[model samples]
Structure formats: C-alpha cells, structure tokens
Target: MREFCDSISSYVSKQLKFSNISIYQKLNVVMSNKVYDLQYKCQLDDNVLVVAVCYFTQYLQTQQINKISAALNVFSTCAVLASKYIDDDSFQSEFFSDKLQIESETLSQLEMHVCQALQYNFALEQNQLVNIQQQLDEILVNNSNTPKMSFLEE
Candidate 1:
C-alpha cells in the first residue's frame, strides 16, 4: 500500500504539474504522528487510504479529465481519515484548501461528490469488523451467567 500510494502520488505530481506529492508526504507524516479521540470516523489506515486515492485517481484518468480538483477533494478526505486514525487529529477544512491547491468553492463541490460516492457511510471499514467482534464477545461474556440468547432455527 505504501508503494501504491507513492506511485499514485508520483503520478499525480507528474500529470497535474502541481505539488501534490508534498501534500501526500505531509498527510503521511500526520497519520504517523498524531492522535485522536473518536472511533467511529471514516479515517483509513495507510494501506486503505492509498488504495482509495488510487481508485479515485484511476477513475478520473479513465475519464480523461485534465482538472484534478475533484480527485484532490476525495484524496483529502481519505488522507484526513488516515491521519486522524493513525495520528489522532481532526481534519481541518483548511487542509483541503491549502494542501491540494484547490480553491474553497471547488473544494466544496468536490466534497459533495465525495459524500455522494461514499453514500454518506462514514463508519464502514475493516477495522469496524474488529470492533463489532469485540462487542459480540462482550455480549457473550455478559450472557454467560444467564440463559443463552439463542438464534431460532428454521
């Protein structure tokens, strides 16, 4: 995933002739260094963030869109999530404006598209599966001293 992220960042840097690589590097640093309190956020770990960015970028490339403002918005969301999860910092709206070289108006539109693409589902991920398993285990332990809660069979 690290390699993939690096590759995508590199590709974007070349294609856009914009300084997106530095933004990606900063995002990596933030994820590795910060800390957060919330658990239900949509932040990706490094691997998944990279994959998501690559997925979006590849989609844009296929469409032959010279403008990357939209892709950067999606990338910002993924990067912010990664940073929040790994580093524990909330993603500021300013980060989108400053890092991706996008203006406020364009960022707003991109944000809307990103939300639509994600179906407003911000808490679904592999890590959530772990959390769900933990909750289920706690339920089992709490029920151990009582009659079991059984699933009905057909």
Candidate 2:
C-alpha cells in the first residue's frame, strides 16, 4: 500500500509537476478528514470508504494526470458516488457539498465528470473489493500517525 502511494506521488510529481510533496500530504490529510466526516455525519457504512478508494483508483487508471484541483474533484466525487451506491438513503449533492465545503455546482460538475470518466460503470467484483480492502488495511496499519478508524470493522 505504501508502495502504491509512493508510486502515485512519483507519477504525479513527474507528470503533473503541479505542486510539491507538501501539497500531496495536505491533500491526503484533507481527503481523510472529509471521508471521516462523511462517514460520521451520514452514518455511511465503511464500505463506502473502501469503494471510494476503488473508484479513485479506477479514475486514476482511466484519466491522464491533471492539476491538483481536478484530482481532488474526482476523489470527492468518488466518495459521493460510493456512498450513494452502497447506501440507499445517501445524502444529496447539496449535503455533500456542505460537508466537503465545496460549492454545490462545482460538486455537481465534478460528479458528472467522474461518472463520465467511469463510463457509467460502477460494478466491482467481490475479489476486487477484497483486494482494495486489503490494501486499505495495510495503509492504515503502516500510517499510524493518522487517526485510525476500523473502516472494515463491523
């Protein structure tokens, strides 16, 4: 998992040249916080987080490297979509926008972009989910400095 993040960091740095390492660190912190907030506030299952990670990985695999803002938008949209996919009573875009502190219109646009990037396909095989969950577990275990949550725990 650490290797995955390191490779992504290296790729983004070499290809995008958008910002320094500190910016990526900050983005990780912010995204982590937002995912936690989404879970807590929406009472979403932790599978949402796992699925969001999968969606983000899929988005990265599909798209070219871009600016930090674009990357963040895609990530945020992934979380929103994951929640909606797993939770029938998921919150709407306005709710996500408020929780994420992003403008509603911007969030909507990003959501559309992510949906298109995904080619409207959101299915994940059981094995894929298991693999992603394992990677997420390793990431959480290795990064003890980050506040821990049992994302896959019942």
Candidate 3:
C-alpha cells in the first residue's frame, strides 16, 4: 500500500512540478487517508478502493494537471465517482470537498471534467476490479518488510 502511494506521489510531483515536495506529500496523505475513511464511513465495499485507485491512475495519465490543486481535484473527484459506482451508498461533492479541504464548486467542476475525460465510461467489470485488487495485493506483499511513513503523519 505504501509503495503504491509513494509511486503515485512521485508521479504526481514530477508531473505537476511542485516546487515544494510537501504538496505532493499532502496530496498523497489526503488520498490515502480519505480512501480508507470512506471505506468505513460510507460502509463501502473493499472493491471501491481498488476501482478508485485505477480511476486515479487513469486520470493522472490522461489529464494534464499542472498544479497540486488540480491533482487534488482529480483525486477527490475520482474517489467520489468510484464510491458511487462501486458502493450502495455514495457521498456528495460537499462531503468529499470537506474531507479534501477544497471548495465544493471546484470539486463539482472537476467531477464534470473527469466524467468527460473518461468519455462517461464509469463502468468497471467485476473481473477488472478483481485484477486491480490482486495487483495491489502483490505490491503490498512484496514490500511488506519496508518501513514507511504515512503521509498523513507528516
């Protein structure tokens, strides 16, 4: 889990050219922390996190996010969409915006942009979600011994 988060943080940091690495760290913290929180808070299924990570990676690759704020918008929007698609209960933009410390209007706009970028294809087959979970599990197992810090703790 930590490795996956680190790779995403490095990728976003480089892509956005954040002058302060702390921005990327904060983004990583917010994403990891909130994803876990939503899993319990919304009574979301475990697959929701897998789908959210997949959507986040896809969004990062396809979108041109030039700032940390843009990256947060994308991440937060993806989380909301993923939960809606994967879980019985879904959170509103205001809920996620408060968690991410962003404005609700910005999150709504980003959600629209993300939906358009994805061509409105929000469906994830069961097998696809399973595969993503498997891959992430393998990563966690391989890096099990490595000591790491939660970005949230920093």
Say which candidate scores most in TM-score.
2
After superposition, the stretches of candidate 3 with alpha carbons farther than 4 Å from their true spots are 1-45, 145-154
What are the per-residue Cα lDDT tens digits for candidate 1 across 1-154? 2332333344444444435767555544432222110111333343444334433444344344333443445566545543444454646656645555567677667656655655544454554434433433344445344332221111
| Model 1: worst 10 consecutive residues (lDDT sum) | 31-40
User: Best to worst by lDDT, what's the order?
Assistant: 2, 3, 1
> Residue 129 CA error for candidate 3 (Å)?
1.8
Relative to the true structure, how large is the alpha-carbon lDDT of every model? 0.43, 0.67, 0.62
Off by over 4 Å in 2: 1-20, 145-154
In terms of TM-score, which candidate is stronger, 1 or 2? 2
Give the residue spans of candidate 1 off by over 4 A. Answer: 1-4, 7-73, 81-88, 127-154
Task: Give every collision pair in model 3.
Answer: none
**Between prediction 1 and prediction 3, which has the larger lDDT?**
3
How does candidate 2 score on lDDT? 0.67
Alpha-carbon shift of residue 141 in model 3 (angstroms)? 0.7
Residue 18 miss distance in model 1 (angstroms): 20
TM-score of candidate 2 on Cα atoms, chains taken together: 0.74
lDDT of 2 by residue, 100-137 (tens): 78899988888888999889889988887777666555
